[model samples]
Target: MKRILSAALTLPLLAAVGACGAYGSSAQPSGPQPRAAAATASAGALPTAPGSVTIGSADFPESELLAHLYADAMKARGVRTEIHADIGERAVSMAALKEGSIGAIPEYTGDLLAYLSSASTARTPQDIYARLRQAAGAQGLTVTAYAPAQDADTVTVTRATADTYHLSSIGDLKTVAHRLAFGAPAPTRTLPYGLPGLKSAYGVTFRQFVPLAPTGTITQNALRNNTVDAADIFSTDPFIPRYKLVSLKDPKHIFAAQNIVPLFRRDVLTQPMADACDAVSAKLTTTALAELDSQVANGASPDAVATTWLTATGLAH
Candidate 1:
């Protein structure tokens, strides 16, 4: 997976990514900020029954934007959709998926795999996607093709902090770990890719662990405000470079390669829906994804941004 680039998400993720696309980031569920698409032809969350089909996303702009991409693509195929946006934390959405509340969501290969199997040894994209498919299948889910784009979690520090500490790799923190505070999602305490793993793999033990929102923005903000010395910001989040944050290197490969993919309910994946997402996925490279994120951050609506991307890439007309 690292051969190309890196990974982010929104909650229990069963941490999604309490994974990201911050997947390269865990839970607390938020209520649905449902953004229902106008009724059209049918696809995406291809419901076998009568009710409206819903696509779910974690509480971050990237995830929401991903949901919009799926919706917009499906719309082009004739299916309208309701986005169960901001479906808080990991557990709630995982439960929702199991119970049929949402049919699909954008996910990171590594993060989703990590969330399902913390003990897994899979690493490469092939291995990770294979593992993830198994894990998701057991839960009655189907994963669409993964996009080249990724948004892995990065142990980011402000340029000032990086300069002050002479840090570049995550292992560098070991020397000053005891003096600095770490900010991330609440579940970081237990997630293999978070504090405990960092400590075990890199011997990193921060002076404090601030439980920030799973939303990369909050944690990234805390890093900027000096509320926390280092935070887990998504690799593709435009704010990283904008803020001049330094993403510490992971020499030990603590974080897995987290490529973006579609995680969906098996029953909801019609051929048209799957084909539409796969078409878009084929075009979603890391650089393309970062630009899409930048657009939303600059105030473009997720739907608008997604539509623009689809049209530009000729995935949609």
Candidate 2:
């Protein structure tokens, strides 16, 4: 969806958390292990199954595609694996990993940073990945090299509203603030990147704020039907393009960079596994991501879409 957050909005996400604790210490995975990583610890080590891994993904079409990609990539490495698609939000998914329910989960670098530490300054993708990897390590998780694709946060308005108000940036909404109603995830109303930044960066506040529908469809429909003037939408949402909505530029960078990364439990990042994941990250890209998303949005079965993509991209035989 969206890529890098401009420097301005990036601050809030960073400011919300402080320095992440050191990651060398990680939460150990649950269950029996094939081999012990060290002399005395049975936990926090990869299973000795040698060539098998489990990957988890969050809810949403893009995530499903990613899960497929990861599963396919690992399969190519001669690794047996399971794909746990739609594992809910980050917190829940991370919990799944921490509990050893799944070996690895895709995460956003900025999100992990915000979760680990609250500094808001702009950091290039490379830096973000390194930091996440290090922080994840502390929790007994490892952030594998990040992928090229980034589904950053986006604030969007109806195409009609944008044209009518000449609202081009988050700043422009200030003048017409009273006339607009914004809808976002329930948390955005109070979160750092939520209303506070709108007040701080744009000097504007909405006449009303509504809860984003539990599923994105409701929010998307609300925006289309004019039930809401604006709403939070991911940069790559197929509906954005399909509906011809106007994606307000986040010149202030309120949303953080959310590059896709695999967050692995200690058991999954053995050197060979890490290298296999890196290959997937290197090949994945925004354009490719958009295409995979479109397949599901267009109504193809997820498995069929994932299968086609894997073969076409040569990620799977």
Candidate 3:
């Protein structure tokens, strides 16, 4: 989705997303700790076993769906595969990639960039991916070219909550954020574009921070059921429109461009396998991804969704 931030956003806050700590109330809480920090002992020190072909995913529907697509495409090319679904967020996912627990996983370019360096100023998709590629290369990871499909993070609210707070943009939450409870995946609370970004960029802090699961269903249910007054949701999530939730504008580009991509361990990525993944990346557009995600969210198995899309695109038969 193309975001057009309204004129209401203050000009000075434009720089808040990049280098903060100077802009806000300084109430940034230490968010959820990543689960992978414990396993870094073997990271980069040992090579993944040569005979294995495993794909992993973050603990969310889209990530799992993408994993299924990649595995199926590789399988069609005579490479057998196994999937490790719901493997937590970037921290855990990255650890899996580093230690060879997983040969590959689905990832977003900008988010991966931010994880490497939260202060990075890469904005456009090309710049972000280039920076991400360089950073990832240094760590023995390979980043494939990104897809047209993007799902930038958004600070969303129910229509009722939006109306109550007159919330139209991220900046609009500045005044009443303290009274609201914010919900999102554990990693988001600490990500620069998540709670910290909100606090620095908009001087927004909530009454409480609820570290919920990364799954869209669980996150959306919390919002719809009033478990939390606000949430950080992905832009392409089907529930954004289906549930009539309002995704607030981000004029500062805090969340940045998040095109879909595959992250592979350098040792595990072969020419044929990389090409198989790239074929899917080239064919998977935002609209196509949304449909696939919707099917999975509504009870269709990710294997089934992957089969249909791969068959239609001629990536698998």
Best by TM-score: 2
Model 1: per-residue lDDT, tens digit, 1-317?
21111223322111111222222222101232111111112224445333235899876677888888877787677665789888865566778888998988878777678777878897555567767777877777768777766677568888898889898778888999899998876777787778888899999999999988665567666877889998776667676656666777665566776777878777776656766777777777655777788888777888899988888877777
Candidate 1: what lDDT? Answer: 0.68
Candidate 3, which ten residues in sequence have the lowest lDDT sum?
13-22
lDDT of 2: 0.62
**What's the residue-level lDDT of 106 in candidate 1?**
79
- Which lDDT tens digits does candidate 2 get at residues 33-89? 112123114344444444666788776556666777777777776777898876676
Whose TM-score is higher: candidate 2's or candidate 3's?
A: 2
Candidate 3's residue-wise lDDT over 178-276, tens digit each? 899998767666877678877898889899999875556677789999999887666666666577777776666676777778888877765556667
Each prediction's TM-score against the native?
Answer: 0.67, 0.71, 0.63
Q: With candidate 1 superimposed using the best TM-score fit, by how many Å does residue 65's alpha carbon deviate from the native?
A: 1.5
| Model 1 residue 265 CA deviation in Å | 2.8
The lDDT of each candidate is: 0.68, 0.62, 0.68
RMSD of each: 9.2, 10.3, 11.5
**Any runs in candidate 1 off by more than 4 Å, and if so which?**
1-54, 58-60, 77-102, 114-124, 160-166, 174-181, 185-191, 205-222, 225-228
Query: Which residue runs does candidate 3 get wrong by more than 4 Å?
Result: 1-52, 86-89, 157-231, 244-251
lDDT of 1 at 149: 67
